[model samples]
Target: MPRDPLSRLQWLVFALVSAVFTTVYIPQPVLPVLRQTFGVGEGTASLTVSAVVLGIALANLPFGALADRMAIRPILLTGGLVVAAAGVVSALAPTLPLLVGARFVQGLFVPALTTCLAAYLAKVMPAERLNVVMGSYVSATVVGGLSGRLLGGFVFPPGHWRWAFLVAAALLLAATLAAYVGLPVEDHEKARQAEGVRFRDVLFRHDLFRIYCVSAGGFFVFSSVFNYMPFYLHGAPFHWSTRAVTLLYLSYIVGVVAGPLAGRLSNRIGNGAAMVVGSLVFGAGLAVTLIPQGWAMALALALVCAGFFTIHASAAGALNRKLSTGRGRANAFYTLFYYLGGTAGITLSGHAYHLAGWHGVVALAAGVLLVPLSTGLVEMRLAQRDGSATRSSVARAR
Candidate 1:
């Protein structure tokens, strides 16, 4: 068999998508700095982090539909440009409102990049390599996330917040150019000629509904922990500097190791089982973080990263394959819920933090994880029942 060219394209797409996502999250570590500099309250400052996610969630479905209609490359290019422009605008905004608006616009472009990129990869890659490639892409995203936080924290000391955005914009621009030059252009006419079912119908299916809920619930828990951890650490006995706090993102490397491994494991065991185990592990990891000590916190963060990546990798890959039609749309639906949860989780957890403190936040997160953990178990049982039914049918046919 000849080697697959699409696999290479998927790798490049992963890189480009990861870079764009990095630009969106670069403000996370600097949220407190923005609060102080802009003279805003903590709730308002947190909007700097939440707005982009809200934007991504709002745009995911539209962009996914667009990808089904248009060539993926053009959509991706436009998204990249819009995101970069938003970054520049955000870096230059003089007021909190203007910066928030720019961040929202930056987020709007995010789904275009991410949705198109994922769909493009799905269209190009072979089934055998799909999980591995997606795993790599997920790891790249984790790295981008880590880099974004580190850059924001390390670079924005006193008056250097703008530099963080500038650096992110530059990196995104470079990645965009690389993507434009390296990615293969899709043939629109051929894509149009290939017959497939409409995505709206796919949305109405019961099986997919379960999957979307699982994906969303899983991400909600994942984002809640990551988004609030720094805030929690900044408050307590640790009272770490921004740079010191951002260094916690170094734990994201655990996801880098776990993603591909989880993907491979999902291929062997059922994805439902993988998702269940991963969610359980993630919940346990969050439990570890309740220790209130720095070293224990570090260990808990590492476990959180591992568990998040494991569940996310498996669930996302399963989503791509679960649907018989409208794969792109399905993925978009997953992304929509995924990011929506992120936005909701961050905003809601902020309140939890205010009300009950770090313990409250952890409890809220664990409660959210339980939703997906329970869903995964249900999915596993359903899969087993289906398998038994199939075997019985085969026996009757024989």
Candidate 2:
């Protein structure tokens, strides 16, 4: 329990975030099943998945504002409890409407912790080691999303999606309890020394705004592609079953390694260069999905996973680096756009899937990747300019 950068508190936050994010996608892999079980249409069944994202988009800024004032630990504990309660309500839902309602409530509170984590670390951790901890946290999100998805579609017995909710609730409860017990006690005096960040200052940098908007576009493509992937696999030449389709999410395993690798790469090169590499790789993977074969699709997904995480980790690092002050509000605004992209992706692309088929969705994702790639190129130039300036300054000093 020393005040080292990689303390037990960091790991506790990592674990807690993973558990909280599981709720984000518990119903994702099982959307088709929910359709049949509840006798709802494709769009209606999808509401079970999209509702939570919408809630997260709606709540991130408001809850982010809340995190600026309150201590993060107590807020996290309360949010976890609320999430656990919502899970129980979801498990007991006799109808889809009730289940969607429960998920919305869960989404509303979970950001209470997710939004605060980066800012809290910025306050407490030494600057040099922040990327390692943040990378671990991003990796945890991949694990949680994959875990909840697999739990819904494969781990639980058929017709027992409720068990998935129960297990998720248990994990949430455990993460909350452990965080409360094990996390380092905050230095209230140190915390009080700095009042909350002014979001206006965080936004004053035009470069930061470009990065944030580009991030939203990147996540938008990522969300739409993943949201409708099962449907594509379930149709035509492949005709995969639910379990088979759910197993594809395991490809997200690549993200576990990609997060840290991307972070380290950004640490060496620049965040913008890392982002460009990521976008190129991600676009390549997305393009590969045009192939109609199963193994090819799987390989494509793996590439997609790796590329997406690379962009995600690097972008987050760049954002945090820029927000030397007001880390809380800065991160909150970042997540605000992030989840908003997710909400928009699911809503708009669901219509594309209905009218134009999976290829249309792919086409859209490919087009959207341009926003990030363009911004990433601009960032690379900026980083190069800054580095040259630093070198010249050093030479002059000598």
- Model 1 segments more than 4 A misplaced: 1-11, 123-136, 155-159, 191-195, 390-398
- Clashing residue pairs in candidate 2 are none
lDDT of each: 0.79, 0.82
Q: Write the per-residue lDDT of candidate 2 for residues 296-322, one digit (tens) a residue.
A: 889988989888888888888888787
User: What pairs collide in candidate 1?
Assistant: none
After superposing candidate 2, which stretches have Cα over 4 Å from the reference?
A: 1-7, 124-132, 189-197, 387-398
RMSD of 1: 2.9
Q: Which consecutive 10 residues in model 1 have the weakest lDDT in total? A: 190-199
